[model samples]
Target: IELNAFVAYQREREAISDSAPARQLFNWCREAGLNARGLEHALLLRDRIGAVCRRLGLPWVEAEPAGNPEPVLRALTRGFFGQVSIFSSGLRG
Candidate 1:
């Protein structure tokens, strides 16, 4: 569980909030029995992801201006946040 958490946290910190790495981290947390209610850590992880993406010029579909945005990043963020919300809620319950 510790290893998983560490990996997840690291991935989240290094990638975009909705990137594959961030999603993987959240998945790890869920599989490791970390409660969604304890998702302050996860939220921090997401924040890190968002920062990294911003630095890397990744476009956030929901937040970015309309244009020829990075489709991969947009999709990833949508899926990532959606999964996070769903799994996080499951943990809460």
Candidate 2:
């Protein structure tokens, strides 16, 4: 899912071509239990969806972690930094 999402992202950014990953993505998604119609719909909207995800800084979890939290943390921070708020204060006003 992550790999396909990245490939779709690249395609949306014009860094890759739409046809490049189609077969592999379809096969992988099929094996992962995604139906044909769903895949078709996703592909059809890949450009728009991918662009939106990119613009919104959404995380795609691109790699498999081996008991490591670094990658996941990085992705999350990059994606949600703008939306996360941290406040430090004392009880007294």
Which candidate should be chosen as best, given lDDT against the real structure? 1
Per-residue lDDT tens digits for candidate 2, residues 13-49, read 3442467566555565566665545656655786686
Per-model RMSD to reference: 15.2, 10.5
Model 1, 1-93: lDDT tens digits are 233454454555466455475466557657767653466565686689899999999974453443334754676799999999999999988
> Where does the lowest 10-residue lDDT sum fall in candidate 2?
84-93
Pairs in clash, predicted candidate 1: 17-49
lDDT of 1 at 22: 48
TM-score of each: 0.28, 0.24
Query: CA lDDT of 14 in candidate 2?
Result: 49
How does model 2 fare in lDDT?
0.56
